[model samples]
Target: MWVTSSTDKVLTPSAIALGNFDGIHRGHQKVLQPILQASAVIGCPASARKVIRDSQCPYATVVTFNPHPQEFFTGQSKQLLTPLPEKVKLLEQLGVEQLVLLPFDRELAALSPQQFVEEILMRQLQATRISVGEDFRFGHKRAGTAEDLRAIAAKFGVEVVITSLQTCQGNESEQPTLRISSSAIRQALAEGDIDRANRMLGRAYTLMGTVVKGQQLGKTIGFPTANLQLPPTKLLPRYGVYCVKVFLEGEGENIITQSSIKGVMNIGCRPTVAGNTPTVEVHLLDWAGNLYGKTLTASLEKFLRPEQKFPSIDALKAQIAFDCDLARKILERST
Candidate 1:
């Protein structure tokens, strides 16, 4: 897939999905559906499927911003659920042909609703169609609504598709349907509701890091671990114990060495050991070897318990033993 900046040239007659798409959750997929279908039909042999006419056929494109806009406006770095590289991978998997990353700088932020549509969409991209959620907003101060986009783009003979917000049950039954969104996913992660978050994401929420040498605290207690040093801007799930799957991967993070290694992960400061710095460490069940400097991909599966202080090192060791047993049972049942 092609990744472009605002200044870069885009394919003409573009069918664009416009959004931040931070997590590329199911809701975002709904907005992208129309363009994806068009791209698919346009790419295949005409004999296989009905082909759209060249005048109507379009490049499936996504327009999103970098720096999160929030991070740009607030001048504070924000934790990211899907960083740029991950976003590119996900969009490519969904068949997006082009991704335009509008740098969220002061100049772009100053555009009004009229200029954004006429300058960015019509002039720069020459978009033939635009897709956005009903709740979507844009332009300076978020002054442009989805309806506004429809009205403005109509003058240029561009079709606008506005999708309703996608929602899912909050529980098994008798609960409200919550809208699936990036913010909602963040809330789920903050509460350690990994299962719900993954459901919304349509895939495992993977955390990647390099294994670093630690003090061997877990090894001292017969629970040897591989310490992971994560990117500072990654959005971490709540500090706690979790049932997880760890995958060994190549340095570039594209090659998987195995299916997965079941494990229990701990994320927090080691209160019992008098450690104040927060850490993420995993103990691969029934496995032991040097892992220093290796890269790992951890999939948070189930939340077992929140981080807490223990009375003694012996108490902590006992609790860890129990956690391992529970995690094994959970992983087994899940498989």
Candidate 2:
């Protein structure tokens, strides 16, 4: 996929999907499908020709804002389900051709509704058609609604597709339907409801980071761990130990190992060791390799236990050992 800044010159007309798309959850996929189909038809490659019939297609593009408009306006760091790089990777996997990451600053935030449509959507992106969720809002102070977008799009000879809000069947008996949203997913993660979050995401929740050196505390305790340094804006699950599957890949290399290793991960400030800084540390079972500087993607399988301050180092070690044993059993059963 071609990634370009929004300020870059617009060469091709596009059928764009508009949203923050933090998690690219099922609902986001529903909104993106039409745009993906339109783009696939237009830019059908030789390898994809067998799947997509020959037809004129516009550029398949995703127009999203950076720093999340909420973060920009509120001056507070907003945790994100998918960071910029991860979001780009997800879009590419979904067959998006281009990603236009618009800078969301005070200047861009001040644009009137009409100015946003005339400038960014029309002049900059040259959008032939735009797809957005029903509740999507844009322009200064979110003054523009999906209806406003449709009205403005008509004047520019652009087609606007507004998708209705999507819901998934609830797991509980009392509530039959639950809205599938990024906010809902965030709330689930915040509350350590891994199962519900994964269901809404249509995939396991994963945290990707570069392995960094730590104090080697886990190593001394006989459960060596790879310390991960995640992006500051990345959203983390509730602080605790979790059953996880770890994927390790080389730095600056496209090679990804096919098999994942079962592991136990801790996300918290190590209170037992009198540590105050929060960290993500994972110990892969039966794995032996140096992962320093490598990228590791850890997918949360289940919540094990909350982080706590053990009375002694021995007690902490014992608890971790038990956690690992349980995690292994859980993972084995799943397999």
Using lDDT as the measure, the top candidate is: 2
In model 2, which regions exceed 4 Å deviation?
46-55, 251-255
Model 2, backbone clash pairs (residues 3+ apart or across chains), number: 1
Every candidate's lDDT: 0.86, 0.87
Candidate 1 residue lDDT tens string, 1-335: 87888545676667899999988888899999987776556655434323343655677899988878898989999998987776887899888878998888888899999999999999888788899999999999999999999999999988899999888767674247777888889999998888789888877787788999889999889999999988788788999999898888665433447788899999989888998999999999987666777888888889999999999999999999999999999998888
lDDT of 2 at 210: 94
Cα lDDT for residue 267, candidate 2:
98
Cα displacement (angstroms), candidate 1, residue 211, comes to 2.4
Write model 2 residue lDDT over 156-198, tens digit each, in one string. Answer: 8888999999887778742687799999999989999898888
Local lDDT at 3 for model 2: 84
Q: Count the backbone clashes (under 3 Å) in each candidate.
A: 0, 1
What is the C-alpha RMSD, rounded to one decimal, of candidate 1?
Answer: 3.5
Which pairs of residues collide in candidate 2?
Answer: 42-57
lDDT for 70 (candidate 1):
92
Clashing pairs in 1: none
